[model samples]
Target: MARYFKYKSTADVMADAQSLGHELALADDLSPLFRPVTIGGRKAGNRLLVQPMEGCDGTLDGRPDELTFRRYQRFGGGGAKVIWGEATAICDEVRANTRQLLMAEHTLTGLEQMRRVTRAAHRAECGDDGDLLVGLQLTHSGRYSVRKPLLAMHDPLLDPLIVDKSTGRRVDASYSLLSDDDLKRIEDQFVVAARRAAHLGYDFIDLKQCHRYLLSELLAAKNRPGEYGGCLENRTRLIRNVIGRIRSEVPGLLIATRMNCYDGIPYRGVGEGENFIGQPCPHELPLVAAFGTNPHDHREEDLTEPLQVARDLRDWGVSLINVTLGNPYGNPHVIRPAEFPPIDGYYPPEHPLLGVLRHFRVARQIQAAVPEIPIVGSGYSWLQDFAPQAAAANIAAGHVALAGFGRATLSHPDFARTLQTEGRLNRKQVCRTFSYCTGLMRAKDHPLGQFPTGCPPFDKEVYGPIWKEVEQRT
Candidate 1:
């Protein structure tokens, strides 16, 4: 029942969506996706934005090495107007992976060179990049931090899921939570990082607050007692203050956020049939501990706070808000609808279509409420060849300002180009959603492994043998 991608027709996709109690619509003409958009006085040539997906292959000093530069060049030449640069660490201590890119004074030169090549590639392939809006995502991995699982708030749902790399077992350790003073320093760090990005000529900076990151975790800090916790104003003070600083300091630089409107807990229960078809057991945990969740009944979603947050961000003069859901660390299927799970992932609790629908439905709600702010809608990669159809429909209907792709970009960097020129995606180049890229990443965290990430099958020269080796070990 979960293998919805096996059906090869749009009719089958629609029928499956109906079976899952949702509606999936598509546009006949995808011109809306190629339309230009303006944000914070900056213009993007097209509505196709690349999602900020980390390669975990940067230099040890956190600079964009050869692999990183090549990936961005492909993305630029591929015709996506907005190249949402992958998450770069604001501070070295909070780096997600050993090789995660870092935005710092020392590494600025490498980053600048990388951007030059990317824009050069864009001009060489797409003719011009005058309207191109390239942004850098500033992030602190928070509880998911590899260097130190830094915490602003203790999450009931996610705490148990943290496995110690040494033991490979779930054991809670007293990793220090950031004090209010520490939070202030981190806020300063973000501002400093933004200044660097502006100097590097990044069109925008995405203050990433999604997928259970530090900022997102702080939003769920209802239990913590401090000036930066308890109430909504207190909880969001960090991001608000950080943005306020950037706005005051960096005059015309665009600001955006990849925010999670909903954060869901991982499902745990007995498998259904021989094929594990039915839904997993309901998550019985109380949801008040998490942001954008019902306090009265934890299982249900309450978007009141999330919407208010959006409105507040709009008031803060944010240009774009990339709408996504769930923590990839804990609930990846919610954010990415994969037919096959990652190496250390779970069977999808629902149809991939339902997963895709959740993103658009939530995005539509936010778009209607915050009409002033343009939004980049996620979860379309699961649509495969039909992604452009669905994305264009949403864009034309005024549901979202742009259609974002991540995993699909890894396999087919030329997807947006093909979609624009041929009016359809090359079926062979479309991501089959093998999730081998994610598998390679997960493999890195297992005991002793360091595998470079990319679409193993598509990028066979390097990651192909690594994928085979890792597959055999697993």
Candidate 2:
């Protein structure tokens, strides 16, 4: 495998970027990352954000388990002011995994307790939770739903990639699509989930519309007939309705969306083991089943629709927008520029730095398009310890309002706190983007059908044995 993270210092990283003819925004003064930012009339203590990351450790009945509470407690004390909670299923049937957190009346108390534990931890470490903005991301897994493939619409490219657990065969044209009424029911569930989140004292709720989930797939449902497909207006009808209903019903709750600006075509790994390289699946021109992608050339991004969606979301009362790229199940490299691919993934077709630049460029475009709303930027974890510098630079440049961290947070939950006290991240604890967490996420041989994900390399006490078992099995 080709190793990319060889920089010994930030200066070296800058020099490498310079040699690649890409100018990376790196600030010596990281104050931009510490500045307070307002989202939905509420002020976050800092520009640092903990991006929603699922541990897949909830109880089978969809309640937060011990590991779930532990993950949130660490994030709470980690110093990020905006805590974007992980994807929680709006109902039991739509869960992506058996243990995916489900927001329902039966599990509301555990969810509430989980939030309390997080806030308490934050108060204990940071001395107060006044400026803390905690939120939950409500979603329907759609095609990835663990119970079965609950598809919004069928795509020739994506269909073959989905394996039906019952038949142990890839999904074909015979697979049914979710009806309009089904979608409406899902939208209603989102409002119900929003109410539950508000009742639990969550400052905001993210209508999860990213990573090819039901809502995200709907955004690309141009070929599907009816009210929730074809034209952009039709495609966004469900989410817009959900937002309007939440505004009418749950008056005080803030609405947000972790949206996909690009949904590139699926890819497959070729060759064996260490030699595997990623290549896009066969696709025809004008790829109709994807959002924010250049129809003529699926490899490139076309943000016209995404930009319009952002403006619409803002006008419709969306308080914050977390900008992300590519579906993790298909184009993982585009969403996460990692040094090493996950066990099921392939070596990146492009340089990891190039992937990082793509994220910066795309986010800059979206942020520039919608300057009114706060945009949380992703794809920074691969930068390792220098992520804060890049985040500060992006903030200083007005490219993004908040710097969001995902895998990095799993490894170094106290990154923000360390930056505040020590002025830098602990290099030893910084995420190298090995994708071990993702590896765990993909491992389904466990008793619960999914393994909890954490930084096994650093948080060895908890995940080390788990990682060992995964390695042995794989």
Candidate 3:
């Protein structure tokens, strides 16, 4: 039933790309992916990084639950030198979902245990953990917060999409925006979380600024007045302030960020049943509610400010950067190219290969601009069995410093090891871009309000039953 990804070989994939008027790169020699890269004076074992893939399996009080420990243990042994931890809430009130992890004093022991288990697993599998770099991504969910819709700035297009759980109604003009004072308090929380991460011996802490979360949304608040809005300088004020404080207070701790290079306009499914296709929402332009997007044409990328932000982040002491595209909530295809959509999602408007190419091109621009800093490129999971070849090609061409995998890692944790030892991924385990993990994420009818997401097809033992449950409920 899939329209794309019918290629039997890498050559076939490339030929299809050519037919689509895009050049898809593939390298038979994958050595470029095995080279060690320096980040904050520390050497990661290789250029492969496990992008922060949230499990959403934490406890009610914000501690890593049993499944959380298991997921990280697998990732630890999975062979990626840099295991970027999942997004952990800065405070309880800002959690994106009920089961989202929280980094705080009460949960410090649980976090330490999670790290300990991950490292132990890595050592058990790889024989040593000296070259491993583990980090925790700290975040504030903002408009997506489960408690309520917390706004940084109002967007006519996105505001109507946010249904405040507390009121069970979409937010309107009357919904209060986060005040300057509120942001100051949130900034302090970020610092505190970073300090906690350092105290717990995390290799680094990620200041999450992607996916239209609080900080990401702030980047597009050009029309809003005050310190955290308007011009680029003001728009990036909160992140800049948080980075400065973390550097001053937690001196030796390294800082990283997963930032959005482009935030495309929101889309909605327009057709019936299986025939549904994504269609852009009606909106007036010049679009002022998005970052790295052309105001006159919301669909086209204008990375001038995004490039500058990368440069500024480098100068501001961020050791490395992860470049991502689109707001997952608004435009899933741009962020994650998939063959099939999630249960509540729409078919991708363009070819998934084109979406993957967009990631490579935008990431190449950022990597070139900040040549001194390592840039982790995303959107590779859609490549399926050929992801490694594509990653190698990108690294060889100097398009990106590291190749990050999210859904791929969930399906095959030992992807790096397999590539190094066998030179190919286990085809049986490669994620097919079916969006089964995403379907589990969208299933919120559980007693705890979320189903732990993993590869329901490949990781069948744990997630298979969960998927069955979701099917029954939905």
Candidate 4:
């Protein structure tokens, strides 16, 4: 059991971070969280942003379904200034899930309607919509690509772990890696998507280069040959090129990037059969390859390259840079600070607070290095009721411009509103980091096709029956 399960107050959480050799402060007041701020040339109503947490519930033709509309409606009305939309695929085949939204000619009108719903919800809840900035994340799930996995460059770290979750068996197959010509086509598709996003009235578009996706994987492509591989410049060519075209063609929409500033190497089990699990101290040795880390010592980060990437993005005219770490597919604990592991996830190798500290410190480092650029920080969902205090402290300290939440919002979408009006969180409504959302999604898609994802066990009324059936079977 986690030590935090017994912690009862905000001070206890802060003390735990300090006892672990990491410092996290509690807010004296909630003013910092409610203060208005500006990013990418537009002013925001407050400093909180709803991080892109995808709900795999879109229609077959890539349009937002009722579930999708409800999720963003809560985000818009919940008082977060920036509603950072979830990852929507540029093309249908490259989607991460069967129901992942896609940006296309047929989906434009529906996408527009989704945005209108958000705006109306915001106006109704907050009395104004001028300060809310909504954006869409465009991505191609590289190794975890939907229907068929499309990898940029294969490596031993991630390839061997690919499994057919339905049977809990490792898949053995030689998958085709995407070529440079294929990358060029993908880049063009992104440019086209940006054009449509602009027309649909999205304030910005997050050219997502994170989470070991296609563009992010290219950043670690040291082995592949040709113009789109090798050096950092070549690796970033696709995103930079896409940005240039979007500026030339669309011009009106702003650009932002949700980038993975650091990647802790992949870890695998070192034991036998069904008992196999992640090595307890896997970071003892360096990683094979990673971004923003010493190639020789993957456990040690060398932010020189990642900092330069931030500078380049700013130079290319990006408004805000949202920072995250690790690949959730291979390294869930790093990206999300969870108490219990999901159905297919590994037991957390260390205390979950370590993951939270790593992200906080990384965001501080980036903010200090590029003081001119604005940054949105992740990993606050694990903070529970104390999230507002911790987020306020960081924002007040200038470590991060906005404190973002993912799973926390899925369970408690009214958190921001409650915090704004009541000045504290409703403890009963806060996420406990049970990771049931992830477990529910996996259960729904193990063999593919099921209910839309929300907080199944916590939200209860709508998802409780499905959770019960899943619990009975497993």
Full ranking by TM-score? 3, 2, 1, 4
CA lDDT scores, all candidates in order: 0.83, 0.92, 0.93, 0.82
lDDT of 2 by residue, 1-474 (tens): 788888878788888888889998688899988899989899899999999999999999999999999999999999999999999999998999988999998999999998998899999999989999999999999999988899888898999988988678789988889999998888889999999899999999999899998889999999899999899999999999999999999998999999999999988999988779999998888787989999998878999999999999999999999999888899899888889998778999888998888888888998998899999999999999889999999999999999999999999999999998899999889999989999999999998888988999999999999999988887
What is the model-wide C-alpha lDDT for candidate 3?
Answer: 0.93
Query: Tens digits of per-residue lDDT for model 3 on 217-330?
Result: 999999778899999999999999999999999999999999999998999988887679888999998897989999899778999999999999999999999999987778
Error of 4 at 377 (Å): 0.1
Please list the residue runs of candidate 1 whose C-alpha ends up more than 4 Å from where it truly belongs after superposition: 163-175, 269-285, 296-299, 445-449, 472-474
In TM-score terms, candidate 4 sits at: 0.93
Could you tell me every candidate's TM-score relative to the true structure? 0.94, 0.98, 0.99, 0.93
TM-score of 3: 0.99
Best by lDDT: 3
Per-residue lDDT of model 4, residues 412-473, tens digit only: 88788889989987787788888888876676533445446788756788667767877887
Instruction: Name the runs in model 2 displaced over 4 angstroms.
Output: none
Model 2, backbone clash pairs (residues 3+ apart or across chains), number: 0
The CA root-mean-square deviation of candidate 4, after full C-alpha superposition on the true structure, stands at 2.9
**TM-score, cand. 2 vs. native:** 0.98
